[model samples]
Target: MLDSGLYEQLHKALWVQKKLSETVARHWVTTEYQGLTLSSHFQPIFSISHRRPVGYEGLLRASTDSGALIPPPAVLVLPNNSKENLELDRACRQLHLQNFARQETGDCWLFLNLNSQCLVTEQPDAGFMNRLFETTGIHPSRLVIEILESEITDRSYLKQLIKHFRSLGCLIAIDDFGAGHSNFDRIWELEPDIVKIDRSLVQEAGKSSRVERILTGIVSLIHEAGSLVVLEGVETRREALVSIAANADMVQGFYFAKPQQLISSNHEEFVSVIDELLQHQQRQRFKNTHQINENFRKIERLFKRAINHFSVTQNFEESSEILFAEKRSVRCYLLDDAGYQMARNIYSPHYQQTMDVRFTPLLSGDNANWSHKHYHFRAVQHPGQMQLSRPYLSVADSRMCITVSQTVTSSDKQFVFCCDLDWQDN
Candidate 1:
């Protein structure tokens, strides 16, 4: 309903915008992520673990003649003509193919980045990719396609794409997760192979120390989907430390090592560095153990003193008088070779009843080493005699006691009788 001149103006503006976008796309300004030059944060603290090529992450990058790196464009663009899109696909595929070929030096994994728009292309010229894979002969397992799924644009289409690629033996991942503000519903539906924690969240992780609580919950959520979590953008030691504590399975960030050309011969160097760090960590742990042992010794001494006090008391009736004073009851146990197998009690009608009472071993028999069921007692069976006998339980007063009938002797056959204890009843 606009006037002719106004409509023309608006159309011209849109045309200008489109042309500008195309121009930016044409120049390789390095508009995407840089290459595999990742590093670890532990490098500064414990030295870089630089002996082995742990794994290689596919970094998407483009550069112009000026030698400046250009990050890949964030937005998806399709040219007016199918010819341009097809040509672009071919060139991009070739870049990846070449990159992967150079990267397959050992057991290193090739983590390639895939945009949602690209995978769903109707007829991308995948010939170059197929040829590159064929030349490398790397198992599909070695190639992990990292899908930077910001949000589920098309659920059905995304799932179908995942199935197709998975069938090709490639793994799928959903990246830039938290920043994208994605819903857990989308994650459950897509069921990606990996979910990378956003770098933004990691950067803020330790500034408040609240990172762990948040990251832990996030990791727990991701695991419930039957997929692992890879913490991305680990640029600092603090971040790396916290991430590990948060139970991150794998870490990919500049903290370990920046992405680089094939690790080639430097694999051993990486491993050596790791060994050195492990040794240093071990030394620190040893020191900590010594400190803990010293404290434990102090505690042990105190415990022994308390046990000795309990073992040396000899007046049971007198001690129990303070607790059950009116009852005038006294009980004792033997600590000689005639030990009780298990706990038992004996009943006596009068102080002289023990003179004719029959006593049997409480927990006696074959399994002597494991005789924890009973305790030996050289108890005050009568007013003057401390008799040692079998364990017995007395129904008369709900008490466990033993008759002192047998005696223990030393190696020279001398009677030894010093272990007498009387604990105060509460």
Candidate 2:
């Protein structure tokens, strides 16, 4: 619901929009221009945590008098001048508002796309939205003004217009934020409440694991910037999983629902989709965890054996023989209490054969200081306990590996025994 005071202020502030009271009716509002009829269709934007639609993005649907449809991209150009642009933009909003008001909107928002040209226009009249809100009995707070900041060249004017919208108590969203020419500069300047990620990013994330990680990082950055993320164009189950993995706050696409003339009240269908995705994710996580534990159990046995042998014989290479027998074990080395390497790395026969000679300079870590590594500090922090580090690229072989470190004392001096196990398979 919109706030009454906000509507009062808006109605008093401006009158730029063309009057549409005659066109407005009980169930819908339509504007005719150049023999074409314009109406509004809504596509839902769902909240991942809420498992329900938090809003619907209002899209324009234009058709000829003969009932042939005109794509929305072509509809914007129907208005030639700034005045016509303002009129069409306002008419579209009025139509969306009236139709949306007739539904059980509850507290969900109505996302309206404001033309950039109309936003920057120096037209005299204002208060169109104000009068519309008053007429439709929909609160301004329920409105979300989506602006494609990249299209507006006059950023100062854009900022002022956004500020005005904010003053009217409408939420602001930066639409298609990950598309061409879009940058964080507008996000920093406008400080929008929501940033809708472009579908291209969603498509790329679904195609590549590296892109999936990047998408997660991008979502994290947006959250840090104090705005929620809406991953748009999630058209498949894989893309939906990517959205969840990226931690996007909301999702909108054909995977859940498509744009329609009427809003669907059946939220259980959307809930079921999200429920199944979560279940699949949970199963995958359990399987990964179980596999990691099983692998660790085998490696730990060999690691303990090596440590015991080294403690008795004080021979690094001889003791590491048992560990090297594992196909995944890359190398083992001893480090002093201060993290200085105590011996040259004892590599597995497999590593020696497949090792890249280009990294010959880094192959021998004897006398190298590993104090800066997380595995070293973690092992030092908890003496006598095994520390398992997350998989990372090993500086020694340039291959991905997980480090298992344990601190042990020999001859009254502490030493850290560390082994690198290849993580390419798991």
Candidate 3:
């Protein structure tokens, strides 16, 4: 009894609904790679601050007909055919989307790995991803595309691809950072939401104090760049502690949980572990700070007493000898307001004897201008206040030393008193 126009519209609506249903059904269909079924296993990525799992990385794994597992590399290997590689990549992504839906992991992001070479070379089907998202019910915003850092060669193409992904509401991450000629310039251009420090760096950091310091510095830089850092490959308590000390935003590795068929159910245990590590770090920091403050106070008192004596002494050389006996100072000199040395340096006898012949040029620094030195300018600004310079190799002895400078007035003439202290002894 409906009008002709209404009947035609209703029939079209029904047909469209049928087609949408078919597309949704097709999204769940599994793909086979070399007669093996592909599936996804998720590894949880935890937030150090929150002490909870913020998201999961979907790792692709294949299973044979006999139910034997196939490693990811084996499944991903393509025989020099771009078409096959693209197909495999699509299949892996689809599998991840399907499994994510099946697992019901709650409002958490799914980090999916994208091959940089594939993305750079292939012209991706725009509608294909739109259809997949629509059919699978996985929103683009909840997905994070992690690109391997080493594989990217053509940055222009990569930037365009990243823009395309972002337009779809997906976040970007640079994985395996600090490995294989990692470029900070490119990273800043990419402006990724996350940077995963390579496992090798994390492992080396745990084993070497120097490497740990470097890792910490790297993490600090990454944070300054407006991105989160994930210290990957933490396999022991020491490694986790190292990551925490580095101030990593997140930590992931076997120490927490290995990549398994299902997301980890032991969230409480991991949280406890993180809390314990944070407590230990806090205690250690408090102890170190207290000790350092005490040491600084002692050093200040020593310098103040020495300066009082030096100001009162009529014989400068005798006072210098007394000061050198009490403190492990290398040399002391007087400089005018213009940063030109006013007198010869009073070098410690023991230090002078050990000085390298190659550095004899430094001994004749009287009347030399030091206006370019940071300590000179800083001391001028804060007259009568002591300023310390960071440790640097001394030009006189080729040994590490710290420079301390103080601007003082004697008989209405302002002069800067500069002293060098052995860094190791200090």
Candidate 4:
């Protein structure tokens, strides 16, 4: 007979052995999918500030017995069973981590793509992932899980999943952002560490100025929300410049390097390219700033001439007529020292007929106070100098316009002479 203590110890040993064997078997099964050997390719993610490769995203690749490459999308297709999908997901992750371990990555992060379906259907086993990380000698902080923005359905559940991964010291990234079904509401809720702008946006921005403006605004908004932006799929120098202009923190695309089996040791080469791009961007920004300053000077001269004429004639209509004859001023109005309108707005003949009925109430000179307006206060501060307001909605015409105002003292009475200029003209 066996002692109870001895039997208990033997039973515990058997359980540990069984678990280890199962883990190994599971790993072995992932090495091949349907007789095809699975592999991973790395694409470098470059940081604009660093001007070098900061990370590499691991992309899954598969090949057949004869070494024919299979399409990436085909590999993601799984059987109806959720367990099968989970197995494939684990296999891809294992291969990525193994490949990254074997390579000389050198203090850079490894971004791994996570299938949205598997994330929702087969929840991650934290213990298994931790053990795998320990076995591979990869720190959890070095791993970034990239999730497709379009695949997220349950906001609350996704938030919880993000929380779980964050607890494990893994960073979260929203991939293919602005591709389809882009809901900034969910983005705010998830609060991902990184947001990758989609390839389509980058491509379109290269072709259309309007699209570029929108992309720039989106990047600015994302930065304001405390998330780093990665401009993806930059295939040309123009596209990369567009990304730089938009103030993207990172860029990943063919312009840098295509997906490869090994991380290309071309850090110095890329640094040179980024430096040139940075210089070009700086020159362009400087040129734009100079042009804007010139325009401001010209507009100031026009406003000063109009103020001189208004101060002499003390006639809003005649002064506005003279200003509009130059085809720049949209409307002119007068406000007393207390910021109360002194007379009705004198509309430019060119824009007089285009005024919307909704803005009719603004034509009245009663109770309209300009004291709190930036242009009003700024002009008052300078007294005689002209001040230009940033673009704003014009009350008289309900169009985007910039106001140029100057405070003038004519016949012992102080008044603010204001002119509305079309924003498009500026």
Which candidate achieves the best TM-score against the true structure?
Answer: 4
Clash number for each model: 63, 7, 0, 0
- Between prediction 3 and prediction 4, the one with superior lDDT is 4
lDDT of 2 by residue, 332-376 (tens): 989987899999898999888888999998899967999999999
Q: What C-alpha lDDT does candidate 3 achieve relative to the native structure? A: 0.80
- lDDT digits (tens) for residues 250-301 of candidate 4: 9999998899876655588889889999999999889978976786776666
All models: lDDT? 0.50, 0.86, 0.80, 0.83
**Residue pairs whose backbone atoms clash in candidate 4:** none
> How well does each candidate superpose onto the true structure, as a TM-score?
0.50, 0.81, 0.78, 0.82
**TM-score, cand. 4:** 0.82
Q: How does candidate 1 score on lDDT?
A: 0.50
**Which lDDT value does model 2 have at 19?**
29
Off by over 4 Å in 4: 1-30, 294-297, 333-345, 352-383, 389-402, 410-416
What are the clashing pairs of model 2? 2-139, 14-126, 14-127, 15-126, 15-127, 16-125, 16-126
lDDT of 2 at 397: 72
Give lDDT tens digits, candidate 3, residues 1-426. 999999999999788766754654554446777799877777888899988888888888778899998888887775367777887888888888876775546778898998766766678777878887998788898899998867867878778888888998898999999888997886788999999999999999989876887898899988888999988888999999999999999988899888865554448999888889999999999997797567556556656666666666634465456547635578877788989988788988878767778867777776688877877899999988988886666665677777778887766778777778776532
Candidate maximizing lDDT: 2
- Better-scoring candidate (TM-score), 1 or 4: 4
